[model samples]
Target: MNIKFKNFIWGVITLSVISSCDISDNKDVNPADSFLRIYDSHQFDHEIRPVDVTQTADNGYLFLGNYRRDDVDFLGTYISSVDEEGHFIRNTYLRDNNVHPVGKFLVLGGEHYFISMDAVSLQAYLNQVDDSARVVSTIGIGTTYPMYAENDGEDQFVLLSYSSVNRTTVLSLVNADGSITSQSAFGIGAGQEVEEPIIDHFTRTGRELPFFAGRSVDGTYYANGFYNYTLSLLFTDLSDNTPSGVIQGQLDQGGISSLLSLSGDNYAVARFNYGDQYANAIATLNTSGISSSTDIEGNPMLEWAYDEKVKMTTMTLGNADYIIIATTTKNQQIALHFYDNTGAYIAVDYLGFSSPYQLGAIQVTSDNGLAILGSTQVAGKFQRLCLFKKSESELNDLVQ
Candidate 1:
C-alpha cells in the first residue's frame, strides 16, 4: 500500500444499502452511533468509485474500488480503511501498470481476494488482501478476464471469468494461493453463449456486466450471465460445462441487476432492461431437470415496475435472518427494504435527500450495524465516494 495523499478529498456525506443483522443497542444511543462520510478527489481528473466493502475483525471497514484516471489508458485498484466511528484510517493506491481490477471481492477464511486482468497479456490475476487493506500477495490465475466471484459456501472461493479468445465463459474454483484447482468452460455447446458485453467492459466500451458463479443448496453449480447473447441464469454441471436448466431472456433485454440467495433454493433477483428495473422477490432454479423461466415471479416483494439502481444481501441476528434490499428510488433517495427470511416485507427506511446518490456497495458491520457505500455528484459533475453507518439498534428497528 503506497501512501498517496494526492488522490482524493475526504469529507462527510450520507448514504445507505440493502443489508442488515441483529443486536441489542436497539435502544437510545449518542449521535456518534450513526453518521455519514464522503470522500472525493481533486488530486486527479478521473473517476473514483467503490466496488466492495467488508467489516474487519477489529470493527473497522475496508473498501476496494476502481480508480480510473482520465489521462491513463487503464484502471487502477484502491484500498481504503476506516475506524469503527467512520473516521478515515488509510487510503492507498495499489498500482500495477496496465492491470485492471475486476468485479467484487471474494472473502474466504477471513481473507479478501479479488481478480484483476493484465490488459496486455489478457491474463487474470488474483490478489489476496488482508483486513487492514494491505495487498498480501498477487498471482496470475490465467489469461482470462474476470467478471464476478463468490465464496463456494465451504472454505474456498469460485470465480466467474470470460475468455474472449475462446469466446467462452470460464468457471474456476480458485484456491487461496491463486491456484486454479478445477476449471470449466461453457458457450461451446448448444444454446450456450457468453460473449461481448463482458469483453466490451474491459475494452472501455460497455457497462460492467454482472455474472454470478456458485453452487445451489444441492451442491449443483449455478451461474447467471450473458447466455446466448441474452442475460440469462443457468445451472451448469462443472464436470461437463453443460447447462441443465436456464431462464430465458430476450436478446439484450435484461437479467440480474441485484441478487441475494435466500433459504433453500430461492434467490432474490432484481432485474433491469435498458435502464428499467423489476423486482423479482424470490426465484428458484428452472426445475423439470432442464428448462427455463420467462420470469422469476413466485412471491413478489414489491410492485414490479421501472425503478432505480438495486442491490440486496442477507444479514443474521441471533437466530433470525433478515434480507435487506437497497434501491435508488425514483424519488431520488435510497430505499432500504427490510424483509424476513420468508420474503415478507418488514419495514422501509430512507437515506440521502439533499442531492442524488448512487449505491456503490453495502454490507452488515461486525456489530450488526449497516455500512452503505455510495457516490454523490459533487458540483454536479465530480463523482465522490460517500458512506453511511447505522447503529445496532437502528438496524434492529428496520427489521422489526
Candidate 2:
C-alpha cells in the first residue's frame, strides 16, 4: 500500500468530523485538511451520483450528476456550486425540473455549460449556465436526440446521434452557440448489422456505452463509434465521415474504452474486452488502414468488472507532462496511474475506504491538483454524491 493511501484511510476513520445537517452536510473528514465531502439528500427514495465536475473561472467548483427519485420515470440532473474551501453556494438552477444526465460539464471563455435532453420531445439541448449556477439559456440545435457530445479542445464540440431509420451514426461538429457547422453519418447496413445501441438507452430501450467524438491535437476529427459494425475509433473528415484511419476492435465485445490526446498522432488510450482492461502509453492513429486493438500492451492489465468505468486525462507541471488513467479496482477502490509524456509508466495511488466509492470523472484543477467526483452509499443502501481534492504538493510527489 502507498504511504499516502495508508495515511488517508486512517485519517478518514479517526480524524474527520461531520456537522450541521441541511440539504448537504459539508464535512472535513480529516484533520490534515484532506477529507471527503459527502453531499447527502435526506429525502427517501432519491439518489444522486456525480457524472462530471469542472473548475469555474472564479476558482469555485461546479459538479453535475444524475439525481433521481423513485417517482420519476427517468434520471434527472443536478449541479452544486461550492467555493474553494467546500462551502456551499446558493441552490443552483441546475437542479430544476428538466435536467439531463450523461453529458460532460465544460468551461469555455469563463462560462459553464453542458448538454441536456428534453424529456417531452426527446430533443437534445445545449445549456449555458451563469456564474451562480443558474441556467442562462437552453438552446436546442434543431436535433431530435443526442447520443453523445464532447468539446473538441477547440471552441467547437463534436456531437453523435443514432438513426434507426437510416441505420446510421450521425456526426455533427457544433459551435458554442448551439448551431451545427458540419454534419455526416456512418454505420453498417440495417439487416446485416448486430444490434442498435440498446435502442438508444434514454428511450428506455437498451444499454448505454462509453462514447467519445472530438479532435486530436493536430485538429483532425475522430470518434469512437460503429465503423462497419465494430466499435472502433474513426479518424474522419468531418464533412464526409470518411475514415482515413481506423483503430479496429472486436464486434461489440471489445474496443477502445477511453482516449486522451497527448500530442499530434499520439494518444493515451484504454482498451477492454469481456473481463480484462489494458492501456497503451502512446497510440499513433493518424495513418491509414485498420489497426487492431485486441492486445494493447502496457502496465496495469487490470481485471475489470462490468460496472467499472475507465477514463484518461492529461496535465503538465513545470516541463514534464503526465497522463493519468483512473478506474475502479477489483478490490473496490479508485486507482490513479501516472505516466510520463512519452507514455512511460510511473507510480500508482489509491483513494476511498470504509465504503465503495466509484470513480465518475477526474479533472486537473487550476492549481495543478486533482478534483475527483464519484458516488457512495450511506447505510449501505442509499446513493449520494462525494468529492475530494488532492493537493498540488501531493501530485508533485507522485511524479518524483
Can you write out model 2's per-residue Cα lDDT over 1-400, one digit (the tens) per residue? 1122111111233321222113223353322223456655534356777778888777667877766544445567677776765455633424443555555775555577788777666667888876566778888875645666777655777887655556676778887888888887877444544545534445434445666777777877777777688777788777575677787778667888888876777788888776567788787654466787775565547544453677788888667888898887877678888888777788888877777878888988877778887777766786766777776667878789
Candidate 2, clashing residue pairs? Answer: 16-29, 198-206
| Maximum-lDDT candidate | 2
Per-candidate clash tally: 5, 2
User: What are the lDDT figures for the candidates, one per model?
Assistant: 0.66, 0.68
How would you encode candidate 1's per-residue C-alpha lDDT over 1-400 as one tens digit per residue?
1111223334443221211122225454543367776665533354677677777778777877777755445677777777776656777676565356755677777777777777567778888778667788878876477777778854567788777667767788887777788877767323333454565666656665556667766676766666566666666667776667666555555666666666566777776655556565566645325444445663333433342446787887556787888866664567787777767777888887567777767787766778888776665666667778877777776665
- Model 1, residue 268: displacement in angstroms? 1.8
- Worst lDDT window (10 residues) for model 2? 1-10
Per-model C-alpha RMSD: 6.2, 6.0
Instruction: Quickly count the clashes in candidate 2.
Output: 2
